[model samples]
Structures are given as structure tokens and as C-alpha cells.
Target: MANSNGSKAAARDKRQRLTAAAAEVLHRQGVERTTIADIAQLADVPVGNVYYYFKTKDDLVRAALSAHADHLSLKLAHLDRDPDPRARLGALVASWVERRDITARYGCPTGTLAVELDKREPDGIDTEVGQLFRTLVDWVAEQFRRLGQPDPHDLAITFVAANQGMSLLSNALRDPTIMIREGERLRRWLDDLPT
Candidate 1:
């Protein structure tokens, strides 16, 4: 029984490592350019071992997208600790500012992946990738609703759209400072929203 438990633990650990490495590689290389070999090397697992956990590259990509969705959900949920809706929204934007360097270098990880996947023949991953945005927009809209905004849904979509635009411009310019500046602008915009 002890040996079985140990084996299970090891298997879980290795699968987690592979998923993390897959997310990083998918983000950095985009799906078309990343391979199972790249994911295995990044995870420090033998290339063939990756097949044990993921049968196909698309399977790995789906895993990465699922992982990202969980991450985004947790991150947004974390913002709920702040009592003020405005502050919570600011916190969400500030989280992006905190990763400006990475965003500038590689673009928004989810955004880039979604664009890459959409450019290809309609793969099922697009819906998965899109859920991340939908989740985000829903959370933000909920915050707006809590603040008694009449058009919470529209406001949420606009806010997310602005952030994506900023991310795109920041990547194009290779300027992390753009995120910082836009974050500050968003803070002001958040403040100015009708109470």
C-alpha cells in the first residue's frame, strides 16, 4: 500500500511538472512551433515519457489551456479579498503591471495563444482559450454589478478589450513601461466610473 501511494505521488508530481512546462513552452513558442520534445526537455522528462502522460501535442496544448484557465480563475478570485469593487479591479490590472516584463517580451500569454490557435484551422482549443477571457470578463462584470453599474457587462468587456490592446501595443513596442503607464491610466479610469 505504501509503495502504491508513493508511485501515485510520483506520477502526480511528474504530470504537474509536464503541464507547467507545456504551458511555458506553448506560451513562448506558440502552439504551432512547440513540440512534445520541447515540453519534455523543459520538464526534464525523457521525450518518450511525455507520451505516457499526453498522447498527442494537442492533448498537451489542451492541458496547458486548462492549466491557464485555472490560474486565471484563481488570480481573479484572489482579488475578491479586497472589499471595494474598484480596488479589486485595480488589483486585477496591477497584477498585469507586475508581469509587464514578461508581457512585453512574449505578449499576453493567453492572448497570444488564442490568436495563434484562431489563425489555424478551427481547432477545439479556441473555445478553451476563449473561456479564459469569458471567465475574466464575467468576474470583472460581477464586480461592476456589485458597484451598481447599469451596464456592467459592456463595461467589463470594454475594460478587458483595453487591456488586450495595451498588451498588443506593449509587445509591438517591446516596452514594459507601456503596461505600467496603461495600468495607471486604468486605475484612473476605474476611479472615474460612476458610483
Candidate 2:
């Protein structure tokens, strides 16, 4: 039985809505406090339907993160628009600062998963979060390579750490300024590189 494009689109739309709603719930209430019923209500979908889409709460968490990671990947995957590596690297830094949703009540989904991973056994959710970080780092590294720089992997790791550090600053100060300053430092380093 083949499904029509329209039906598939609608299903995807529903899943996206559900994933977003679940993410919001996890962010606001903390993953430990979030419940499937709460996600269902927030999504305006029936409780049974939530379960139908996701077998368990962990499943919902992974799906939400997958969607979030994919959204970010789509946004910055083109971080190498410029032929110059330095320019591309700068763009990568700027993108993180510009797109960061500082007002997010929930922390980074990947960060949350990382913290949770340490407490619990290895699972799909932990793997998904790891993959997201790796993907982001790889993207950053690609830009560094374009610049003919050394240690692309280390540069990517630094960028990832700096981005996460900004989140902590944003949370503490309730301001996005710290990220701007950090982004400037990143650009300055690229500017100083030997031509």
C-alpha cells in the first residue's frame, strides 16, 4: 500500500509539530519532569497519538533532538560560502552567535543529552546527540580547511566549546553580549593567521 505525497507530507508535518512540542516540554520542565501527556497537550494532539508516534519518552526526546540538529545543520551547512577559509570560519562563528536562541528556557538539547548520558547507560538518544556535535564540528573543520589552516579538528572542537561556553554566559547574565565578544575573538584569530 503506497501512501500519497499529500499524506506523507501531512504526516511529516505532524511529526515536526510533535517533536517541537516535546522539545519545548523537555526544555521548560527538564527531561526528568517532562511527561508524554504534557507533550500531547502542548502539541494539541491526543495522548494515544503521542504514543503512536513515539514508543517511549526517550524516543520522543531523540526525535526532537534529531529535528533540532537537522534544523541547525540546514542553517550552517553552507558555512563555506566564501572561497576564503578565514571568511568562511568567520561566517561559522557569526552564524552561531546570530542563531543562538538565548531566551531558550531549555538548554541545548545536545548538552542535555550529554549530561544525561553520563548518568544512564548508553542509548540511542546519547548517540544522536553525539552525532549532532560531530556534525557541527565537522562543518566547522571544513571551513578551517578552506582557510588552509592547521589542526582543523582542534579548531572545530574549540568552536564547539566556545559556542557551549556562550550558552553558559547567556544563562548566567541573561544577555547575548558574551557570545558577540566570543565571536569577535574567533574572527580575530582568523584575521591574525598568516596569509
Candidate 3:
């Protein structure tokens, strides 16, 4: 029984490692350029063992997307600790600024992946990609609603679009300062909004 438990734990660890590596690789290389081998190497697991965790590359991509969603959910949950809705939204923008260099280098992970998958033929994963955006939009809209804003959904959409647009421009321009400057602008915008 002890041995079985140990084996199960090890399997879970390996699966987590593979999923994490897949997310990183997919973000850096975009979906079309990443490979199972690349993820396996990053995870330090043998390529053959990757199959034990994931049957196909798409399965790995789905796992990455799910992992990304889980991560974003955790971040939103953390932001929820703040009492002020505007402060929470500002913190979200600040968090993006914190990763400005990475965003400049790779673009926004969720945004880039969604765009890449969108260009391909319809797959079930595309729906999951949409869910990521929905998660963000819903959370932001709720914050706007808390602030007594009309058309909270529209406000949230604009906020998310601005962040994504900044990320795209930063990446294209290879300039991390764009994220920093935009983050400051967003914080000011949030402050300016009437409560």
C-alpha cells in the first residue's frame, strides 16, 4: 500500500511538471511551433513518458489551457482580498506590469494562445480558449458592478481589450516600457472612474 501511494504521488508530480512545462513552452513558442519533445525536455521527463501523461499534443495543449485557467482563477481570487473594487482592478493591471518583460518577449500567454488556436480549424480546445476570456471578463464585470457602473460588462470588455492591445504592441515593438506605461495609465483610469 505504501508503495502504491508513492507511485501515485510520483505520477501526479510528473503530470504536473509536464503540464507546467507545456504551458511555458506553448506560451514562448506559440502553439504551432511547440512540440511534445520540447515540453518533455523542459519537464526533464523522457519523451516516451510524456505519452503516459498525455496521449497527444492536443491533449497537452488542453492541459496547458486548463492550467492557465486555474492560474488566472487563483490570481483573481487573490485580488478579491482587496475591499475596493477599483483597487482590485488596479492590482490586476499592476500584476501585468510586474510581468512586463515577459509579456514583451512572449506576448500575453492567454491572448497569444487564443489567437493561434483561432487561426486553426475548429477544435474543442478553441472553446476552452474562449472560456479563459470569459473568466476574466466575468470577474472584471463583477468588479465594475460593485462600483455601481452601468454596462459593467462593456466596461470590463474595454479594460481587457486595452490590456491585451498593450501586450500585443509591447511584444511587436519589443518594448517592456509599453506595459509599464499602459499599466500606469490603467491605474489612473481606474482611479478616475466614479465610485
Instruction: Give me the overall lDDT of model 3.
Output: 0.95
Please write out the lDDT profile of model 1 over residues 14-113, one tens digit for every residue. 8998999999999888888998999999999899888999999999999998889889978877888889999999999999999999999899989999
- Give the top-scoring candidate (TM-score): 3
Write the residue-wise lDDT of candidate 2 on 50-98 in tens digits: 7768999998888778777877777675654567766777776787677
Deviation (Å) of 140 in candidate 2 = 1.3
Q: lDDT winner between 1 and 3, please give it.
A: 3
Quote each prediction's TM-score: 0.98, 0.83, 0.99
Off by over 4 Å in 3: none
Could you arrange the candidates by lDDT from highest to lowest?
A: 3, 1, 2
Candidate 3 C-alpha lDDT tens digits along 87-133? 89999999999999999999999999999999989988988999999
Superposed by TM-score, candidate 2 places the C-alpha of residue 32 at a distance from the truth, in angstroms, of 1.1
User: Every model's Cα RMSD, please?
Assistant: 0.8, 2.8, 0.6
What residue runs in model 2 are displaced by over 4 Å at the alpha carbon? 1-9, 99-105
Model 1 root mean square deviation, Cα atoms: 0.8
* lDDT of all predictions: 0.92, 0.75, 0.95
